[model samples]
Target: MKRIESSKAGGSQFIPGYVQATDYSDLESFMVAKLKVTGQLDMQIDSDFQNVDGAVSNAVVPELWTGIRDDVRGVYIGEFAFWYSDYISFIAESPNGQFTSDEEREIIEILSSFRTEN
Candidate 1:
């Protein structure tokens, strides 16, 4: 698992989450499993965005996001993607409050570091 922390001055707090890199047979299976694990199986996809490489799919649900060391209990940002048959997912959360601009940038940088060439 990979971890990233918000800066003290960023006005946000985030628990270190489990950055998952899983191998799946196909994207459909990966999506199904991801939705199940993230408690979004019954939720519809609300956003889709293009990343540096693959596309990212997201669903916002009021569910508890469990990480390696902590559980963020609130509305959290759940993002997932499939690259070269590898499934990736992570919960981007702010426990203290809303994320500031700096916090958002830092979070993106941390997530981007997990990207790999197909």
Candidate 2:
């Protein structure tokens, strides 16, 4: 993992980590399957950087995705921000397929398994 900072903000810093996968889409797909969406995700996920939607569409609070511009719809989940596509649409929102206690535990385990190989 690497830490990056903004030179303009008098040294505001952020830690960034990327989880690379050969089947990268698999993780996104897992997230979608694990998510419990009560309604539509309000954006598209499968595309690249050009076409994306913001958190407001999903009713997510701004604080949740820091550094996200109003014009930016893609949201960062941990070190990764997801798009509004089928593979990337996942949220912790209640009643929107709230993760069960066991599921939450599983997710924690999954995230915990991550390590910076470099």
Candidate 3:
């Protein structure tokens, strides 16, 4: 897998070695099945470019937003962040229909553990 790295002016950085999947539809489907949510569910994952001050000049950062069927579920437990030019989204579904506050915290912890530096 190719290594990806990004750094910001304030020393904020992200360097992950894991291979990013081009398509996450299958993963979403699996999670929906595991969670046993009724009806069809759609996963929304996208990124937008934003200008940010870097070490030398203004740099573009990809802001990522990821979530699953927020309309069907009342509380949306998803991730949104701005990381060096790469957008990363770790999707998780709660088996109890909707993610509780505790479950959201746990998911955030799990995703944060994968952070790495080059």
Candidate 4:
């Protein structure tokens, strides 16, 4: 489990999460599973951009996905996944759910910070 936390509030504010990288097949199909997941609501894919992950097997075209999880138990989830060649890197968080606005901003910051360390 991984979390982003801030201690500036006199206490830690955090989002519980999980992340992993592995092999997989299909991008849209992978997302479709999350969308159809029982607790997922308001889910959709943003095709705003496409990029590469040079650290992978050659000719491995990467596809990214951002997802929302819906569970009526007041659980809101934010997820990110990248698929390329036969591998996948994924992240899911907000175990207690998220405020859409707050989640969006934080997600942007996280995405923006993604880079390859030489």
TM-score for predicted model 2 compared with the true structure: 0.26
Across 21-87, the per-residue lDDT of candidate 1 in tens digits comes to 5443232211111121222111244232212221122222112321221122323232332234333
TM-score of 4: 0.27
Model 2 C-alpha lDDT per residue in residues 19-60, reported as the tens digit of each score: 453333332212111211122223455222333221111222
Which is the winner by lDDT between candidate 1 and candidate 2? Answer: 1
Off by over 4 Å in 1: 1-88
Q: Which model is ahead, 3 or 4, in terms of TM-score?
A: 3
Against the true structure, what is each candidate's TM-score? 0.28, 0.26, 0.28, 0.27
Which is superior by lDDT, 2 or 3? 3
Model 2 regions more than 4 Å off:
1-72, 75-96
**Evaluation by TM-score, superior candidate among 2 and 4:** 4
lDDT of every predicted structure (CA atoms): 0.30, 0.29, 0.29, 0.27
lDDT of 2 at 59: 22
lDDT of 3 by residue, 24-52 (tens): 32222111111222233224432322222
Per-residue error for 84 in candidate 3, Å, reads 13
Which runs of model 3 end up more than 4 angstroms from their true locations?
1-62, 66-89
Q: How far off is residue 88 in model 4, in Å? A: 6.0
